[model samples]
Target: MTYVLTFLPWIVYAVLPSAHWQWAALAGLVVAVGVIVRQRAAGYRPDALIIECGSAVFFAALAALAFADPDSSLHPYSGALSSGVLALIAGVSLAIRRPFTLGIAKQSTPPQIWDHPVFVRTNTVVTALWTLAFAVTAAVLAVLAHAGQGHSTAATLVQIAGFVAPMLFTKRYVAAVQARSVPQ
Candidate 1:
């Protein structure tokens, strides 16, 4: 579990750079489901499931966008978002003050992401903000659609997926921190 948690951020970093905007989110969704199933099979409680799934899906989408350009061009919003996501990861790590020991899952740890009030509150607030961002973006899409504006709906979808990546990855970050304090 520890190794998996640690590598998730790296996975996001890798995937976002290579995927097209149109497919980043879809790819993220797939990644999230895969991780959730894996975590459940490993005997994680429901709390763990939420954190694991949310982060994986989020990171996958974000990753698809982050590395959208092989040259790592900053032209794309995905790249920008990816940067923000990385910053968030770093910030969370610093706050936790743990050097991040990987492979805690090998011991089959319990889900305790919500045990710390501060973490739980911060994560929840971030998730809520993410929801609001999604809503606003949806509104923008609806207006654009009504005005018959924009070239590719596919592209829009991909960008939206990129936005979701942060939220998902954020959740994963929270869960990983919680997992650190949880007993096996």
Candidate 2:
């Protein structure tokens, strides 16, 4: 069920090149909000605030772009990237919790930190920073689009290009702070 919403945008991109990206982006939002609610309802207090914050920033940035131009420059890629940023944080956190590698850390307290707030803020900041990058990328694309150049049609391609270093760096840093020792 979730997988459909997760990859549908990409699938849509491949099959229907002429489709409006905003529609797929809206669909992705609906799916993400629904999943977040479901997860919260299931007693999974898995840092919803940070996710919400990141989502808000990402959306706000898109809204900025949308305000720039309703007809031409309002690309779905911004909103999609916004949604994707939170999705990546959530997905990575879940993967760490389940039957996966680094399971022991899911169980250790860091001696360097007193509470989760530090890393929670770190994750939030990381996501927000990425969201800013998303905005910059959007601006670049918009300019190029106005100039009649570049692949602005590609959904969040700029983000994927710029996201790796920050994501990996933040992940490793936060994991160091929050990972628990496995109870043997």
Best of the candidates, lDDT: 1
Score every model by TM-score: 0.36, 0.46
lDDT of 2 by residue, 1-184 (tens): 3223323333333233323444443444444455556546654334433343344344444445444554544453333444355446445544453211122122233535423455445544554554454456556555554555433444336535444545565567666654642244
Query: In terms of TM-score, which candidate is strongest?
Result: 2
Q: List the residue pairs that clash in candidate 2.
A: 105-180, 107-180, 107-181, 108-179, 108-180, 108-181
- Where model 1 places Cα greater than 4 Å from the true spot, the runs are 1-35, 48-113, 149-184
Model 1, position 68: C-alpha lDDT score: 62
User: Could you tell me which 10 consecutive residues in candidate 1 have the lowest summed lDDT?
Assistant: 98-107
Summarize candidate 1's per-residue lDDT along 85-128 as a digit string, tens digits: 43454344335642111112223433574345555455555544
| C-alpha-based local distance difference test score of model 1 | 0.47
Looking at candidate 2, the ten consecutive residues that score lowest on lDDT are 98-107
Clash count for each candidate, listed in order shown: 14, 6
